[model samples]
Target: MAQTATRHAKLWFAGQAENWALAAYEIDELHEGMEDAGKYHPTHKQIKQAIPELIAQYVDQPLTALEQAINAKNKAEFIANYDKLTAGCNACHQATEFGFNVVQRPSFNPFANQAF
Candidate 1:
């Protein structure tokens, strides 16, 4: 059951990676899905390690920090953080032995002028 839930979480993470602006609720649901899968599993453990930034981004005030980064006009730093998040996705895929299944990185963010 844990592994099944983990698989589902992986799916959510994959979709989230593909389009983060789809819905903010998806993020916490993904995290909760991962947590519900158990902490002992490798992917869950990796998620435990990887969630701080996510928490920061969603719960721990990631958007404000993003605003600060943007305010500073530091596209590089933003990209670095975005890359860090992507690395987490890669880390989990690698740990799950699906390393060949490279997760797609975000391209052309869909948040600029679209109605949510």
Candidate 2:
């Protein structure tokens, strides 16, 4: 989840900077992180649904949309779908009783070593 969070923030910065390649890479990383989460922790004790199911229900569509936006290089669509993705993350967190771990767009970049 920590890596996902970092990738999420990096994705936002990359998209905001119009660095499509980096955004695409981050998106892929995010997808991989999701896959790993589902693979490693298929079920959460507090959540009735499987982790993979939650991911499919919430994150998948937005991720697809994000990919399309990246392909088109559409900033408006990218921002809109990014918010959707963030909402999906929050929805899953809420479902898993981790609502307090709300995710938002990065207010500032912490990865000073990497240029987006």
Candidate 3:
């Protein structure tokens, strides 16, 4: 989850800077992390829904849109879909009773070592 959060923030910065290559890499990383989560923890004892199911419902479509936006190099579409993806993350957290783990656009870049 922590890794996912970092990638999420980095993805935002990459896209904002119009660094399509980095954004694409981050998107792939994010997707792989989600897939690994689903594979390793199919179900949480507290959450009624399966982890994979929840991810499919909340993340997949927005992720696809994000990919398309990046492919087109469309900043406006990328930002809109990015917010949608963030909302999906929050929605998943809410579903898992982890609503406190709210995610938002990065207000500041924390990865100073890596140029976005």
User: Best by TM-score, which number?
Assistant: 3
Off by over 4 Å in 3: none
lDDT of 3 by residue, 1-116 (tens): 99999999999999999999999999999999999999999998799999999999999999999999999999999999999999999999999999998999999998989987
Q: What is the lDDT of residue 72 in candidate 1?
A: 54
Residue 35 in model 1: shift from native, Å? 0.9
All models, RMSD in angstroms = 9.1, 0.9, 0.7
lDDT ranking of the models? 3, 2, 1
Worst 10 residues of 2 by lDDT: 43-52
Q: How many residue pairs in model 1 have overlapping backbones?
A: 3
Per-prediction TM-score, please?
0.38, 0.96, 0.97
Candidates' C-alpha lDDT: 0.43, 0.94, 0.96
Worst 10 residues of 1 by lDDT: 58-67
Model 1, global lDDT: 0.43
Error of 3 at 32 (Å): 0.8
